[model samples]
Target: MVSLSGSWLANGGGIWMLAAFYGATAAYGIHVGDRSSEVVESTRDVGDAAANFAGFKISTVNLSGQNHVSPGEILATAGVKPTSSLPFLDAEAARMRLEEMAWIKRATVQKFYPDRLDIQVVERQGYALWQKDGKINVIARDGTVIAPYSDDPRYVKLPIVVGEGAEAHVVEIVEALDLVPGVRDQVRAAIRVADRRWTLKLRNGIDVRLPETGLDGALASLAVFDRDKSLLSRDITVVDLRLADRVTVRLSDAAYEARQADLKARAKAKKGSNT
Candidate 1:
């Protein structure tokens, strides 16, 4: 006989149930023609009893695709120790906390009925080692810092970049080196010089100075020079390609001594011819 008519648009099982119960109790009070302030208290008790009877306590939490960070670490960061009832647990809040971790890129939290939670995490993958101020850290492709670098075999194959603001320019350097296939293997590290140009440290203790602008063209010319003259194999300490047109070479001590000797002998012969 209770007809308290109005729109009650509630969604989700828990929310709908709670709203419907409260609404039904209010309507029933009007039909009973008696003041029943105890309806609210009674409904709350029944709701608590139903939630407990449904086995809504969180007991098991399953995490998938979590490799770099252990579940214990996630649980600690999430601040969501189990034994919390599923009906009142804030899943999105827990997920936000998990995403705050550096290793975790994204996270999805799913509530399984009764007593379990399933969490799927996407961890960041390191693209290179960033060496700055003599310290190394692992960096992702998008230049996000993953962790401090140690000599891990898992990331041994990745390129190592050095100097200030090197992470931001890693992709540029790698792509330019890719264009110059001959120069890639000889390069041991790509170091940012004054945060402008790149100085590539070669495997044999030589440095190749690349210009700041028009890097692709410079690399192309270097690649051509390497192909024609085997320029990389020369006993040189530095190859300065910072200039627009010409390349300047700084020879190793042995190579410099040999060149000086040849020059001195040619000068002596020219003086004798003049006499």
Candidate 2:
């Protein structure tokens, strides 16, 4: 009985050693096969071997969270197609192509096993239209120029700003406008000149010329005058607040004549009353 037990243990140990040897051989074979397949696939031209790729098959195309870009468009732009080989697929190239689109701010691409590609994208957030050099352009919140100028009516409500260095000074203008009461709402356009002075065109076609120096003071004074006197409602064409102390106004010719005549009539009535 002792001899029989020893023989059984030896047989079991031999079987285990054989199984481990076979498993190691199988793993090495797989590694070699993968390396050889990669070499052959890398040497082959994808464009020329289109018919060979047809056999692998694309099981899934996952573009679930895409908002700005169409899935079909994304696939076409990435040059990804049905039955594309996992080893030959270029995820970085696909991602770069999608990033070229104006609406897509960033894109990430990944490959899933068997036959699936995953794509994720972030779209640009359009903030406002920037006008410069007689052209209107769309700008993002970070002040990046998104698109070129166009006369499209969709952007008609955007404020028109002009003059040298307007693009760099846009944030400052927005800040300044916010400080002035009612000026931001009534402003149709803000023009910046080469000298860095600002001129604002109101919705009512009235121009407010800000001072090259002491602009904040001028804006404050204008705010006070408007609040107390409703100066904007008057028949004034232009308000020149360039000087420090005085506010000069350019009145329409008709209104100016009427005001002068009224003054003279008042004086005549006073003299007659005195007599």
Give the top-scoring candidate (lDDT). Answer: 1
Query: Relative to the unseen true structure, what is the C-alpha lDDT of residue 242 in candidate 2, on a scale of 0 to 100?
Result: 84
Clashing residue pair totals per candidate (backbone < 3 A): 0, 0
Q: Model 2 reaches what TM-score against the true structure?
A: 0.61
Estimate the overall C-alpha local distance difference test score of candidate 1. 0.77
Model 1 weakest 10-residue run by lDDT: 1-10
Global CA lDDT computed for model 2: 0.66
Please, what is the TM-score per model? 0.77, 0.61
Score each candidate by Cα lDDT: 0.77, 0.66
Candidate of highest TM-score: 1
RMSD of each: 10.8, 13.9
